[model samples]
Target: MSTANRSVILAETPTAGAAVWTALAGLAVAMGIGRFAFTPLLPLMQHDAGLSLVQGGWLATANYLGYLAGAVICIAWPPAPARAIRWGLVSIALFTIGMGLTQQLWPWLALRFVAGAASAFVLIGVSAWVMPVLARLHQSARSGEVFAGVGVGICLAGLTALVAGMTAAGSQATWLGLGVIAASFALALWRPFSSDGVQATSMAGGARAPLTGQAWIAALCYGAFGYGYIIPATFLPALAHEAIRSPAVFGWVWPVFGAAAALSTVLAMRVLPALSSRRLWAYAQLVLGLGVVAPVFAINLTVLLFAALCVGGTFMVITMAGIQEAQRLGGAQPARAMALNTTAFALGQIAGPLTVSLFNGGLKLPSVLAALVLAASSLTLGLTARASARSAESRQQTEIHVIRDAGDARTNPRFEMS
Candidate 1:
């Protein structure tokens, strides 16, 4: 290649790689540590801190509520995307570290809530921050690389918990170590998220068209995605702990789950061209529902691992596809639509834990409920697709009628005389 061409390629390569990694770091902390660290840590807390399943449910509920609150705030009072993302990263690190400093249940609850909120901001912020750059670079395919950070973070969290479990490090020390890891990631990400992206004035622009009936269905499906995944995502390790009674064995559950999640996103990115986002999302939900129901019928190690893979594999794909569909339907201004879907998702998360709590650790009931919800949502998407097609056909017929009527009016003698 000529020098000019070689220089251009070199510059583009580094910028693209940097953007991808920055997004990965932000997601790892926001999603893996901020959102899901609770999963692996829950078993430890239950073992050492006298935390009950009901209490664990409550704690999960609190985090979901915080996530909901943060989504609401972002929708209502939009901020600069880059700035919001940086602040979210910092807050996640602090709150995660806070988890280690206190043993009081209430304090832990408060910290989890804040961390949850931070994670939501990070998610939204990362989307708003990274998407525009990718759009400009015409490198949108790399979006999957950025989202894979969630799985990476989850893997790390699981590893941290595993080592702690093996050494009998207890919940307190586990929390401290995870916090340190999160904080280090936060520092390393500080310059990238801070200095790399340009600030958008607001994620949500002025009023856009109202959401369509199909969009409403998509939002509901997004919520169902949250509900369907949370139970397995949160409690799998605990179940593994019960079945295996060895940290080494149970620890593998979460890491495997995370590995599946990370791998799934990359695969989806490649496979998505073959399928529409809506169809892919529906199929994923179907798979997820089956996964949720699997553990109910069987409790062996094999069944549990397969279930974890199901949940992990589809959760992120559903999320990415749901948001993409929102953008597709929302047209120029999708921020509001994305936020609405996210809020719906957070609400679903809140409900999942509460539902689990109500059943008093009744795994079958919650799992069955999740499967039904996923199935219903999948069916709803199918109906929405049909409705959209019918609406388009009706509009086409109406336009043809109007054009013929206008042509006749122009050719009429009465109109010609005038």
Candidate 2:
């Protein structure tokens, strides 16, 4: 209402606590509008652009390869947060726009690879760069919503592509135009991105405590999560259409999945109160696995929607919570802990598509078998959760002993006489 209040609201709303989500939304648009949008528009593009299915798929793979590379860079460089963020933005813009700038398969493959690399950086950098500031800025519960921005962006891009299709044109060139728009999306993020009013320091002081034994378990669990949810996140809508043969109804599902994730995060805040990130993450993974498994048996579009509502919705919560849990177990070197988790997640993601490809588009018994493997790995969460609890208990005991020893010396008669 008042001037100061207005300024405070602006400072805190999109720009505070979970501002990285806002930044992520922009990156998501840059990353998703072209990458995910391509899947929906692939048939049209293949026909109009004179592209083959194999080549088009390769383009997608190239982007993913680049994304993996970006993740590697993120894990390797902990001291360069701002630099990473800036480079990520630049790479996103370049690769996103590059999608529209060229049409040939060779050139497109190069750009898609670039885009994938940029997207990976953005995802990894958020954990490496923006998360610490967010944790200190807002309640742990609120950070859950930040990861949902990917869904929001994905949904938005999907909706954008949908609308662009509904237009009389519905041409593949429209995809290029969407790519053009994506190129500028990240530019809006050029301003200083602060989380909960904390300017991100390129490097924070005070070394993080070394990760506990449990930390590796959490990393492995997070990695498993990467494999479990990505298939649904990336392919659910396509599956919806293929299974039900209704792109219109099915196409809208991914956004709902994104919205589901966004709302679930806000909901989890009301339910889970502590910084027990490992438990929250494991819980999310458990939900995610069910979400993934449910639709596999879905007889209709409604089944897919239910799966989206469950697993698709909780993806961000698991990711944010995993990062937090690792931070909790990690004593002085959170950067290193984060790096470990980053590496594991990257490995899982790289494995996701390859594993799915082996399924041959879920044709035979192999697809169902692979899905079962993912469902089983979801239990990795429970293992990590137990590890986190043990680590927390150990930390509490250490602190209690420190306090007790300090108190005993203070109370000793000799010290008092002196």
Candidate 3:
């Protein structure tokens, strides 16, 4: 290659790699520590702080409510993606640290709520900011790497919890450790998420049209996904603890869950490149539904671990595909579309914990209901994809017919317009 060509390659390669890693880090902090660090830490809190399962459900609901609020705000008045991400990360670090500092239930609820909202902002911000850069660089395939950050973060948090559990450290200490980790990640990411040349244009635009039927269905299915995975996502470690009665044994569940989550995205991209986003989401949802119901059928260590793998493996895949579908359906207003879908998802998440709490910490009935919802939504998504395909095909045929008629009119001069 010429010198100029070599220079172009070098510049593009670094930018693409940097964007992917940065987005991945942002998501890891926002999602793993900010949103879900609570999962692995829940058993510790119950052990050390006398926290009840019902209260835990309430705490989880608080966070999900905050996430819903945050997503709604983004839809109403979207902020600059970089600014949102920076502030959200800072807020998550602070809130996570606050969880370690306080003992009161109310304060914990409040801290978790704020942290949840912050996670949403970061999630949307990362999606909006990084996807455009990847698309521009023709590195769209690397989008999976960005989402895998969630799993990586989760794995690290789970490991931290595992170590804390083995050492007999208090929940407060674990929370503080996670906070410090979140802070370090935020510091590393602060400068990178600052305003850059690759402007996140989606943040500035508003939806021109109301959501279509397909968009609504996508949102509904995404909501089902949120509900389907969250029960296991939130309570897997606790369930494992109940069965195994050993922190060393139970701690491995969350880490395994995170590892499966992180690995599944890369594998899916490579193995199922031909599948449409909606179809992939449908399949993943079906698997997640199975995962959700697995432990209910057999509450053993093996079943719990299998449940983790199933739930963890597919949630991010569904998230990635669901968001990509939103972007596709959003037309010029992808951010708004994402916010809407996220709002639906947050609602589903809120319901999950509340369902557990309402049932007095019961899992069987709730798991069965969630599985049914996932199954129905999966079928709907698959059918929706087929309908969309047929619609697009019909439009193409109609356009082709119009072109042919126009050509005939021009050539024969018999059907010509005035």
Candidate number achieving the greatest lDDT relative to the actual structure:
3
Q: Provide the global lDDT of candidate 1 against the true structure.
A: 0.82
Q: How close is candidate 1 to the true structure, as a TM-score?
A: 0.88
Q: Which candidate number maximizes TM-score?
A: 3
Instruction: Report backbone clashes per prediction.
Output: 0, 12, 0
Candidate 2 lDDT at 9 equals 39
lDDT of 3 at 266: 84
- Give lDDT per model, in order: 0.82, 0.61, 0.89
Off by over 4 Å in 1: 1-14, 195-202, 386-418
For residues 1-418, write the lDDT of model 3, one tens digit per residue.
Answer: 4788656534533388999999999999999999999999999999999999999999999999999999999999898998999999999999999999988899999999999999999999999988888887898888888899999999999999999999998899999989999999899998888763354468667455565567778898889888888899999998998898888888899999999989888888889989999899999998998899998889888899899999999999999998988887776678888998999999999999999988999988999999999999999988789775654355446656866997899898787897
Please write out the lDDT profile of model 2 over residues 1-418, one tens digit for every residue. 4788656634644434436555566546634553455665554454457765445445556665676676666555544554555567667655655666667888877877777766665665555555655555554455656665666666676676556545534534555666566656556665553332332332343243455778787777767776666666656655665665444566677668767765666667677776366667656666776777775565468877887788756877776676677666664456566667766776676566666665555522433543565555556655556656777778767757766776787897654435
Q: Sorted on lDDT, highest at the top, how do the candidates line up?
A: 3, 1, 2
lDDT for position 116 in model 1: 87
Clashes of 3: 0
Q: What is the lDDT of candidate 3?
A: 0.89
